[model samples]
Target chain A: MCTCNKKNEYIPYPAKIESVKKESFDTKTFRVRFTDKNLAESFQYKQGQFMEVSILGVGEAPISITSSPSRKGFLEFNIRATGKVTDAIHALKKGDALYLRGPYGNSFPLEELKGKNLYFIAGGIGLAPLRSLINMVMDNRDDFKHVKILYGAKTPADMCFADELEVWKKIPDTEVWLTVDKPCDAWGCSIGVVTELWKETDVHPENAVAIVCGPAIMIKFVTLALKKSGFAGKDIIMTLERYMKCGIGKCGHCNIAGKFVCTDGPVFSYEQVKAFPEKEHVI
Target chain B: MSKMIEKKKIKGLLKEAVKQWHTYVPQKHIGGDVLIAPLPEEAKELEAALDNISLADDDLVISPKDIFFPQLETMFKFKKGEIAETVESSPKLLFGIKSCDLKGILFADEFFKRDFEDAYYLSRANERLIVVIGCINPPRPGACFCTSAKTGPFAEKGFDLQLVDNGESYFVETGSEKGEEFVAKYSGFFQDESGDAEKAVNSIKAKAEKAVELKIEFQKALDLMANDDFIPEEKYKRIGERCVYCGACVYTCPTCTCFNVFDNAKGDEGTRVRIWDACIFEGYTREASGHNPRNQKWLMACRRYEHKLKYDKAKTNMSGCVGCGRCLASCPVDIGMSKFVQEITEDKKIM
Candidate 1:
């Protein structure tokens, strides 16, 4: 089959930063809209799926969609200026042009979690992906049971979506418990790791699905805490972070124990993470 | 009828073939390594500079991986935030490739197609014409065991044409439409010798089959490691400790298709290119926030073996190890797939 022709899969579409909101000191939430009207209108992705934000000369990195699917027209990414591409992203403001490819990785099984109470646990920039699913579930709040959010950050200055956490707390039929690793005048919340908050909160692990996202070390203790809190291995869902060069599965950078985090998951069950060695993945 | 190409006129045959296609032949470098490169034009003035090149030597140190998935190639040329241009590729001929390396090409194809089709690789692969030469006489020369992997000594299919050196001439078997067209165009260079081709090929195949020296328990090891049916012991830790992560085995592997893409930008104008990457490197799967998933050398080492014996098998139903023994050949630490499998399987408790 001599069908070999010029095919460039790495081609990215232009997206202009519609707006930028300072989420935290190191993190900024950028509202990006595809320059093409049709693309902007048609691009729909589930929670836990991410997009590749390309900073012209810097490179590309997989940024999980921070906005819910219900929030139409524009996509949101909460980027922490940690690496080269991200540092360049931090330099951009309103109307700045960037390139984007994909809404990749498998999404959370929203259908499976239907009728079950949701326990969302996030810390720092880890709250970005969970924010998408959080809002989506909130939009469809009547379908699900009780919704609880137990989130923590390194410090009050490091917390993202403080206003939204307050907004979610005010919503009836939902519980939001916020915490910081250390005390601050701005953050009027408990001081401890996110896992320690599990003991302080009331959670029905039997009918509740526990979703966690944060640093690797935090996830380790969090999973252990969740297991001790009566959550089954399969019941604890977490999205992973890795150095993704190609947002697609072609690049070997994001593979962990034969699983390509770019495609197979950015979202995996605690059981899946446990099957691989503790050192082989950032759960 | 199988076609025969006379041995003396082979160079002339290659010279004529080069005019039609970008033909690559295995040539010896000054350092005694056989390298695969395009046939040089016959510059009458510097003819003495080139040595007498032959196709029927040991297989080249590098496989066809470089031909399709090159070490460095531009994926796309971008301007600021948009792609300005894409690179065009030419049709190519890989001449004198052995069966194992041919299988390696197939493995690479499967790898590129998984999850996301590798555009850089598929573009080059689409324009490729493979001509396999059956290595039956000496079977293989330096560290080879294609037979155990059920890949070679001879290839039955998946090539444009298959050739066998019958001492004085080559018995050619065209396997595709492109091959048939080539045979028709170069009819003068070949003669029908199919009547004796079968008998001659079988004798060579038999000798080569018996000559393969590698005897690692590949399938046994694969089954043990599959689904964590058997966990490897302390030896794996030592194997990982000994590994310097130099990535020699990855570079030389015939079936390894891992890669990483980066951009070379000059201001706002630059190109995005994908370079060869190895899982053995700790940084390969490390996160941006300085958190590495596979922090241990033992885990990287474990991933390599699992990919060879477990993962690729589940994906393609084909053996990841071509048994070309390049991993064993190029590994500086003296630990390769063969050694890894032998040690792990030697005392593994399957229960």
Candidate 2:
């Protein structure tokens, strides 16, 4: 993990893409190996922290770390070809060189969530960042209380890490509820929006910390669902996405008033989000 | 401490200073006015030009913010998968800057140096020297309320040197140690003053204060708005409606420091650049998924006023508006700070 100044000036460590696995038609996960073995060995990132991946001639984009900190020697990022930089990133193949700048931002308060029940909600590709925390909790399964993951995608084909989700189903004291926007003959997951599946779960909200990430629309509805189910404002945490040009706070693009989402948060508590003067419900 | 310079030898003094430093002065152009282009080679042309050309207030176009916090600066460069290491900056001297404009630079300093220091700004700022030329003449039309804002025709800080034009010549006042060094280097051009320097400076201050006709009780307005109960949503909307959302006020205003960064890429080497961004833009608050927190123009307008007048005051013990009145000049619909404040204080509904 590299620490940067306010200007985000730091030494860039070279990294080579070890492999690129297509998760979906639009999304692929890149596993990268750092050039410096010691730097790679000491590398640590919490859930929700992102790295500024630069493709020399192409620009840099903030991509959330998908691989768990418990996992070693390599890092993973699930990239969707949504914009210019990501499109350039998607064009790269195995052995392509790049530069990484972060492990920037405060992460999930895992220590605070240790004894609490964990309710993980993810929509579409949002599972990438949440997977880090989920894997960590699974590694130390007995340290945490009841863990349940409710994931939803636009369709059955859009779901990411299919084989990993199947493995998660066999973990003791863990439950995985998969949902799709529409039902398909080939799909075994529940049909309808993720919020609909959230309504069916009898979550012990008083003793649980709910971690949610997804498209803004999905997160909005999921937040309302969690609130209706008795989750306190502070108990709900969500990772936000904005059009950030600089992963550092100097670029004003990612700021919501005084809070720079790039630095202050990509993850914020419901209490913090509510304090934003411009916040409005989409649904 | 302030000192006086001879009224007769102002041009000679400036010319001598130019030999050593990168000096800038207002120059007239067909388009309007621009700050000091490099001095011409013909020394007589430079000297003769100063007499006919006084400071061009209309030509005062570029904000000093660009001098320190550049619009498109390369933070670093990378090539062949390795970070390229090269840093170069030149010392600068900005002359004939109006006092209100000087205050704007001071505000930027406070913001960049607060809590988390911006080294990029500091690095650039450290390389420059500011020489403020007091606004002997008030700004045209809507540029009168800078005195009320306590940043006016004269400034106390953020200048290495201050030159007060006293008809025959200029009365120079050293503002920083850098100013003193420059003075000491050119000790031949300066002469010991006979206490008349103090009287000249006082008279200039008196003239500037008298020239300011508009006034506002900034503290009272700030107090009224600080109370959430006093400021209503409907009144805020009413005030905001008058704004054209052209972003001219933000672009011209000296203290608005919002910026956006993007990359200009070519082949394998790309430069990430930070450009000026305004809150008034529709996309400023837009999310990636097409949702915007500040979706309404009226709401954004309200935010601009509240952030400068209320929030910045609370955070830094200073109002964000330096009262340069550029907004008043630039706004197509004349709903700038002066008019906005008058409406807020006079209208019972808003008060």
Candidate 3:
């Protein structure tokens, strides 16, 4: 019986954007800290969880927590200027106060992936959520073995976290592979989809887990590719996106069959996702 | 101890009740439709309104769920970027509620208070008292299936007080401490029930249960939905093509709690509002980037029934439908949960 007064769950906490890093032409990573010092210190969240970011007079959108909890500083949100709320968020400068509620939804299974081969597959802005776990794993590199990152974008300019990707490439026992659908003159990566990175690197699914996030089609294909490369249904993990109002389960917008993506998941194994009654609609 | 009240003295008791609680009762509108609405505060208006008070078993056009979860609600008001949550409520008395509708309220009670408490609903619901009037006959004999759904014609629990119609007198059975306190507070209006009152109430309950004529294979349908690989895509397509997307079913449904939130701003000042949203709507599940997984008409149609029958039951152990027949009664297309259940269970196509 938790007696915490949850009456104000809908009301968001005011947070200030400490800094903004341009991820791409349309996406920006905001470094936010809560205005309340106590809240800033107490706030904790796992990788793959999301927050309901609100801009006054605009609206709220679900953005994944791109920063790792292990960092213990400002929280980061990789937001693309696509929706009305994101557009308003994009207009904000440093020191601008926005509102946030929740470090909601289930996070990536961290304890299970320990000491196992880790494969991070992402596409375009989908890399935002995976970056949280990627950085966490990088900080404690001894816990995992053979880290591989397979990322793809539409073009060279669409690639996000380029500096961080470079930093990750230099990590020992880690493989960072990048690809672009349409390469620029300065581009020096493979020119293909993210799944094509398997050709350039070893992708044995033995004692390994492939974490994937992307557009629905990309996830579908990636899951197929992972399975084709001898990955079991439970070995492939993916994060999903949906139109969510309440990051809690009440606002039934994010349900895929019986499971609410907001509460039951935003992260589910391919095994669990494959069993959804409306798997066709979800995947 | 149970008490009894003369059928004729209800109006007088209600008038006296208005001073203490914001009482709601079923009243007939000018258009001849009966609805559960708030009693007027003014004495003159109250008298005239009570004169039209309907105690009939006829279904209300709108369920009493609106009293707690309004179709549209203001979550918070913001001026100059500061939020002021509008959480205010007063003590209320919901009188003459049917068993099915009362069950709907009980179900909603669990939903709004589950993992996260919805302040707007709880503030009102927590302070309210429920007095359910058991129906002697099915409100909509052709549509009501409470017995099949195991929700009515009388609620087994969750009401503060229950009124069993006993010819000239009504037997008042207290269900909770609130009901006991209410009886104590208004002791003059109530009298001790005769020994025959219990036997009479039992007989009435049996009769009411038998009165429900519409009995779809509700349990079988639930089993089929839960156990079988029941993907009736073609059936959904037919129903979807016929559906006008009018949202009458979800609007009138007592258990449908899905809502959409948006900010209404006129400049620096605005309010964040949440309104009832139907799962069948195309834009309900559509992403901001123009991607929609449940985009097709059939898919939206599937989501609604599956949510009510399969998902909600799996999650809450309570089926979303209370068998009030409001969805079928309010629908223009004649597609309702009962009809869908019949269609699936009987292996027949619905026109």
Candidate 4:
């Protein structure tokens, strides 16, 4: 039996929105700071983790932390306004308050990717989680080798973090490749799916680790492409997205087989992911 | 210290218990089924409810799961965008809980305390005073196989107080200091025994063990499950076809601890509630983008048993299915833990 004396992890700390920037047609980036200065300064987390954002009356939804911890004070959540809670969040202004909890779920093992070349493949809104790691690696550029990022969306209009993409491209020793499935007048890149961009890279499989995130169908194709090119399942890491509640493992909604996605991982290697029961686990 | 209370003095003991605690006892409901429920609020309903109050009533119609892990619990409230916690006003006293039911509570306690401690469950479970009475010849004998699960016909470890029947009087033994304090509170009802205490208790246990009619080869079933010597898919498919997904088995189960959290906000006020969730439901694991992992009914059915027999045992050294037999009793399809395990361990011809 475990101790019941620890602080209740469910309690949400109040965060006031400092700024809200629209990233895509549906997604917006909300920069929030804890109401208490002490908590805002003390809170810390790693890349690829998420927080439960609540709208008091509407509900709560798990959104990835888009900002790296290296950027001190305040947090950014790239939320897609799809459901009720998110729609309520979209309606709020810069000065409104929202309940926040977490920095929950496992993160990318930084030590494993330290000396290896990093390949980032993201599509659609899947770029939200991967953006955290891309920034973190850039902040500690001396510890890593060559970094390549492959990003694709339905069209130029669907792309998120347009300003950040420019800054990412300007980072020294980093390669940025952008593509759109449908060619648009404003876009300045090749036209193909996210996996197709991998064909342009010649990074050796032995010395490189690929990080991937996308829809279930997109992940399947990307994983198959990586495996066909001799990348072992252990070397490929992706942050899995599941419908999460409690952020903690207590609420069993995030369970895949007996594995609680919220606790064991929202991030897993291809080896760990293939073990889920077929009926309940996709990607 | 050990003591005995005659069968005639049972009501007096219960009447006194009601005064000190939020008392619940095995009593006959208006429908004549014996259930463990709080003493009715109205005196008008008391007679019907207490008609069959005894140590030897039929294995309760519903197990005592809802007492702690409420089927629908308002965990916290959000008023004016600020969260407020809910507190319990009085602790609960579950009186006349049978041995099998006691083990069920113990299993729930361990499950809720795994990796993360559930404050909603622990707050109620911690302050609860369990007074379990041993089941010697359970009336619903054909429905339960608790002896095979190694949980009961009698409890050995978890309850605060245990009572055993020895002909004219009831033998009382305190399993915790709380039980000893409770005994002192009503000292007039107890009588110090003169005979060999251990021998007498052992005799009652032996008699009770013999009375258990249903037996399952639980270890063999576990081996078959571990080895993947599964029964035919069609058998499970048939069960899936018949199951209506009513979730009665989950609600009545002693150790099922799956729950869902949702915020119910209206106007400027709302509450975040944690409610019971059954794996069989389509909504349990469906993603916002409309992808479902356990979409098939057969998959949910498979997960349910594997959770009870394999996962719980591996994690906690306790079977998720304590063989309380509530699933068998409540499931409309009659496909539950007992039937599934029996199929795994028994011959195909016999099945």
Off by over 4 Å in 2: A1-13, A36-38, A278-283, B36-59, B76-88, B114-119, B225-245, B287-291, B348-351
**CA-RMSD of model 3:** 2.0
User: What would the per-residue lDDT of candidate 1 be over residues A1-283, giving only the tens digit for each residue?
Assistant: 2144434557778999999999898999999999999999998899999988887677888899999998899999999998888999999989998889888899989998899999998878889999999999989888899989988898888989989998998888899988888877766678899877766778668788998898887888888888887999999999988877777887777877667888999899998887876545455
* Candidate RMSDs in order: 2.9, 3.6, 2.0, 2.7
lDDT of 4 by residue, B143-256 (tens): 677788887878887888888888887788888998889888898888898788778989989988888888888877776665442556676676777778888888778777
Q: lDDT score, residue B96, model 4?
A: 82
Per-candidate DockQ versus the true complex?
Answer: 0.53, 0.35, 0.50, 0.49
- Looking at model 2 chain B, which ten-residue stretch has the lowest summed lDDT? B50-59
Candidate closest to the true structure, highest DockQ: 1
Q: How displaced is residue B86 in candidate 2, in Å?
A: 5.8
Query: Comparing to the true complex, what docking class would candidate 4 get?
Result: acceptable
DockQ of 1: 0.53
> lDDT per residue, candidate 3, A1-283, as tens digits?
1122564688898999999999898999999999999999999999999999998789999999999988986899999999889999999999999899998999999999999999999999999999999999998899999999999999989999999999999999998999999999999889999888888998889999999999998898889889999999999999999988899888889988777899888999999998876534677
lDDT tens digits, residue span A209-228, model 4: 99999887788888899898
For each candidate, the alpha-carbon lDDT, in order, equals 0.80, 0.75, 0.89, 0.80
Which is superior by lDDT, 1 or 2? Answer: 1
Residue-level error in angstroms, candidate 1, position B153? 1.5
Instruction: Give the deviation of candidate 2 from the true structure as CA RMSD.
Output: 3.6
TM-score of 2: 0.89
